[model samples]
Target: MSGVVEGLEGRVFTVLGAAGFVGQRVVSRLRAAGAEVFAPARGDPALWTRPLGHVVYAAGLTADYLVRPFDTVEAHVGLLARVLKEAQWESLVYLSSTRLYDSLGAVDAHEALPLRLDPGQPRHLYDLSKALGESLCHTQGQGRARVARLACVYEGAQDADGFLPSLLRQVMAAGAQPGAPRPAIEVPSSPSFERDYVHVSDVVEGLVHLALRGQHTIYNLASGENTSNASLFDGLGRRWACELRATLPAGPSEAPRIRIDRMREEFGWRPKGLHSVLDAMKETCP
Candidate 1:
């Protein structure tokens, strides 16, 4: 993967959710590339202060968005609106999710898919908020914004609330003591269920490329591979040499994967596979 280049040198960047998992990685990458960065943590003194030259809107929720609907809207749409209106930015990158493509029945959801979301559904708030955010970026940015619909970004324990992280943590903990009694890693959903997992570092790479040099306004940053839960556990079991038992319950069908050709062709970037993510986590495990 290409490291951040001198193209970003001397450029000023304002990351809204600077403290977040993705935001932090982005800030680190930008600063490492010699760009001046303003990263405000949640509720910090510089929440929305300093002018934003190149803005990366990495602020948003996932698991907690449903519980806090109003907060979700505020973070996803409200703050984004404020940035678009108040901030002085040359280019903006709005971090969106592949979850927005859930309602579309296509096996491979593309950017051109016409989204038809039912607002009456309680769970649709997350989708609705993101949809609105994308709208704001497209209409408000006036061709200066890039909308990145990220896949399930796996960052190990940093993203513990997510499915892959939770499962990885449980399996690793259970395998920590070899030859000892290990607890079953309980998966809330079925093992056969598949998902698209992109490494956080790869997501940051894609985001940075999009923010700096992408031509298309909308793109999907993903590994372009559909991996099942069973496959993930098998990957873990092969490395740990422990009997990994996961209790999985039958759940709803899986959502379709998103296309990444736009990202590949436009940005000339390809994300690493899920197995690479698993290997990285194992090497980092203490």
Candidate 2:
């Protein structure tokens, strides 16, 4: 433990959703830090998850993610139940969403803010399922679980789950070349709606820190900054050295802004800002 980070040297960790964007990053970080990470293949827990040192449950699905919600919810719930029942590790980090937080118009929210979305809200089937899964983990892992309730994480490559891709499509559409009509860029999001957007790297840092600390704490893992789509497009334009503009639509959907005080206090995780994201997009764009 002298050279390697403490509490992780030679440890066996299990990561659900290892193929996912976030799960893959978490697994890589764990492997780099000298932890043997196990990933349950296709929701099968019995295949490769026996001596678990830590568990990072990052598996999720949605309309944008895949085909449907109900098709994936059972597998997730079953996998979670199995993990809780067989958590040989001292600690577990469940990846819950900030969507459960109230859609507080423009209010800043914290971990203490009660999740206002009814456990049975039917608007988004995915949100409802996530709430149920979180409830299960919270109940079973009362004192042993470290629930890392995360916000939007932008790698800036091609994740359509958030506002980035849609906004990018709009801007690109705005530049639709000669002869080709430039589709309208919706004005409502010209100033991107403010959401707790965190970079995936910082998210990994927070998750890794929580996994090893054994604090049994639930923390809000966010960017700790207020950001809008307008700022994002401006940054992208600078990165590409081209004018990026969009039409501001009326009354964009706004989610609660989560405060990341607990993340900073616990793991010292400060997310990369909009400029960093733009730079990432620049490098990633072909």
Candidate 3:
């Protein structure tokens, strides 16, 4: 178990979307810290009726957001609006994504930078909805809400969606057979496609820190570094003795390096880098 967060013992916490990858981890961490956790199911009427002591709104769609646009909006904005309007909470931490910076094309992604979005683009649906959710939290939260712009979060070879996790899953599956020939892994994305990957546990810690002790309304929960797909595949190939291949041609990584000075200065937090975590996973992989 990870180190428990101080001052969390006996406190009440209500984690929305408790069944999700991130939400599940948040609930586990809170419980391990001796906190009271209420993980309500979707459409649970108690969400609006009961006094939600401290709320972590980890409910949001990813991976399938493009196909499930309506469901994405509801998860990102609809239910959130209801909670802010009706649910009573001492504090609320809304989980937003650093992917919001993808369209900016800037070198450094800071929390205060102005964002631009083209509504006509289909991909903007996810960004637009999440931005609106952040707006709602800021406008209606009555000063009790904080936003965490999380970067790409991964957990080794966990059977979840997302670039890094999916790639790791593929590698693990190919290497499952004992004494099998080295696996030839073909990556779906371009070699230069990159993201600011942060571990799921770090994200949970950052969310809890924001909900409990964050002084700023907005904070970026990221590793403050960008990892390219090429580098990732290279590390995997070396560690697993697998052949690496990329389906797409090499391209420039457009995503900017996310800034984490606020998180570091405020909470004294620093997350493990992608290769460090990957190396650790290699040791434990069967």
Candidate 4:
């Protein structure tokens, strides 16, 4: 609840994918909290060697995973396997995603919900690879690994490609042209589709809490509320005078919400909502 990594000072933490979005945030927090953090350059086996006190495996792909399945597998599974096999760490936290629940057809599901990733569908590689990574941490770490199934994390001002980021970029672009007509954000699917979103900072806090004192092997780090594209874009309109250029066929789509009770009950962690995200965008707009 204090937003500080407990006992962060005088600890050595090794973070993989330290150049990435989440990894960068984690490393920044570690340094700010006075932890001895090691972030090796990604993809070099030799650089991975470090005296680890706690490990955070934050490497993997998202939108490009389908095009680069082999690389995705290597990052999500192979690298983690290599680390678990070699590292002597006090505790490890494996960063996973709530997308693993996509195929399960359950809304607001908990960690106990069963998951199935169809192998025939090549697109499922992302989800399957992440699931395999979670399995590796749970099994190999031997009670030392804690897995955080993060929701859609957006830093608001980053160049990353995701629903909220795309909207944030469009809004910021519109603000550049004074007196211009409201910019339109294209929606690729049913506007009714919704999902949970969490800020990167909140996720970092939860990750730190899990790494330091968590007893559970798996936890869902999310905002605990579903926001539909229609509702979210409408809210954006209020802030930036934007419009939705929806281009998908009208039909049903998966709406993914998740329960964060476990994360709250276990670690006293909760996410800051979209309003806070908007406030951050106003301050950090590029």
Candidate 5:
């Protein structure tokens, strides 16, 4: 396992969802590495006709999946199906979510773990769609596709959606108010809720590594450690000098500790912990 990611200089790459948060970073990183990158916008017909050298399929819904079930399926599977059928690519990397492991409680959430999902359940739509996408890439891609199941990804205190980013924004806003009484930031989740957060930069690196050099069909891109809400709130309360309040009762962690052994052994990739990212965000805060 080499710590060095193989040189991508002059390698042609196409990134779907290039306008998105993670997608944007992937494109930038690929270009910085001297890769010729093509970023086609959504609904661009050229995607079907272009010869995408190494494809990174980063388009998918998250928080809004419930309300946008049809779009979710389309983004996760429908478009991917077309790409697998129509587009020409030497290799492809599909960005899936580790949230698919939510039902596997207390177990090591690895890439080969058998997932239990019920299509009748509305919430499982996202999981099923992504699973189908993964399947299509595997069964139909002729071994040219790989899946990168991403964990909860965060990037400093930037304006983004998700548990960690929202919390960071709240704490930073409270800290910005000078002379105001320390406000009690109400946490919507239980203290026991935990997540394996991986930084966006690490995710971009892992995606590119998998896109170009991955040998496995699936890989978990995560920090391999869980961070509870209690730990996060305590750290934020101490760092920002704000009052911490939990709105929900303590319960079992919804997501298991994601395993990143494949990535580690294959590419020697290691992601920074959530607390460290928080601390760095604090340093840059006003």
Candidate 6:
């Protein structure tokens, strides 16, 4: 993404979660476009030389571990803070999450949504950390950093857990069921419940967009379309005849529709709809 880097060609663009789904794609996109992508988790500090182009901090551990808690949010916040202070980068594109807001759970929400952090309540540490990290970046970077608030990023099939692998397995499975279970996602989620699913590529584009120009602006990088899990399953099952099932109901009454208006207005980035998302998954599925 030299276009994304503009004048940062040959400069080190440190990607933290290099082995992750999104990180891998970002690395590929950058390397393919002739950018020097450095994966920090794979090695030592020597690899991370000076003149860092854009520290795309996407590394994160889920808040699944609650008993013996590790402060991942503070760690990432400190990491970015250190990177910004020491690394030789013009700006940063920290990949924050839409999970920071409950409004982001059911439908579209702008950046104006409330992010009330309750120390008493148990929550996904990742989300809490994301909010903290974003706050740090904004406070520190001021006008030199950009926060790309991403929605759910996926491209491949899903698994038993409604992830990409599960979806893919259902689609490519032998003698796939296509009518009743033609893909039934049983979520307590209302047919009215919606989520803004963002394709990995589109998220990358928004990051690339901000990486090249916008700074310190929090842009919601999403498809801006509220897609119900049932609708998504039905559409794909109709075409692929694969079964997608969800046994549990969805929580969070709010329609967490993520808005991408800022991304569109700022970087001229518009994500492809869910229909195309399924089509791409079908092709990518084995």
- lDDT agreement with native, every candidate: 0.79, 0.68, 0.87, 0.81, 0.87, 0.67
Candidate with better lDDT, 1 vs 4: 4
| Model 2 TM-score on a 0 to 1 scale | 0.80
Off by over 4 Å in 1: 2-4, 41-50, 176-184, 245-253, 284-286
Candidate 4 — worst ten consecutive residues by lDDT sum? 42-51
Estimate the Cα RMSD of every predicted model relative to the unseen true structure: 2.6, 4.4, 2.1, 2.4, 1.9, 3.9
Q: Return the lDDT, model 6, position 31.
A: 86
lDDT of 2 at 256: 72
Runs of candidate 5 exceeding 4 Å displacement: 1-6, 176-181
lDDT of 5: 0.87
Candidate 6 C-alpha lDDT tens digits along 64-171: 436434646544575777777776776788888777766244534787667756565666556676787788777877587888888777766532233444555645
Better of 2 and 5 by lDDT: 5
Positional deviation of residue 183's Cα in model 5 after best superposition, in angstroms: 2.7
Candidate 1 lDDT over 55-95, as tens digits, reads: 89999888888789888999999988987887678889999
What is the TM-score of candidate 3?
0.94
Using TM-score as the measure, name the better of candidate 1 and candidate 4.
Answer: 4
lDDT of 3 at 92: 96
Deviation in angstroms for 133 in model 3?
0.6
Clashes within 3 Å, all models in order? 0, 8, 0, 0, 0, 26
Per-residue lDDT of 245 in model 3? 89
Order the candidates by lDDT, highest first — what do you get?
5, 3, 4, 1, 2, 6
Where model 6 places Cα greater than 4 Å from the true spot, the runs are: 1-11, 47-49, 63-68, 103-108, 158-164, 174-193, 242-253, 283-286
Instruction: Report the lDDT tens digits of candidate 2 across residue range 22-118.
Output: 9998889888878888887874646444667677888777444246556567645766776688656667787877766754565677776665555
lDDT for 258 in candidate 5 is: 88
In TM-score terms, which candidate is top? 5
- Which ten residues in a row are the worst by lDDT in model 6? 183-192
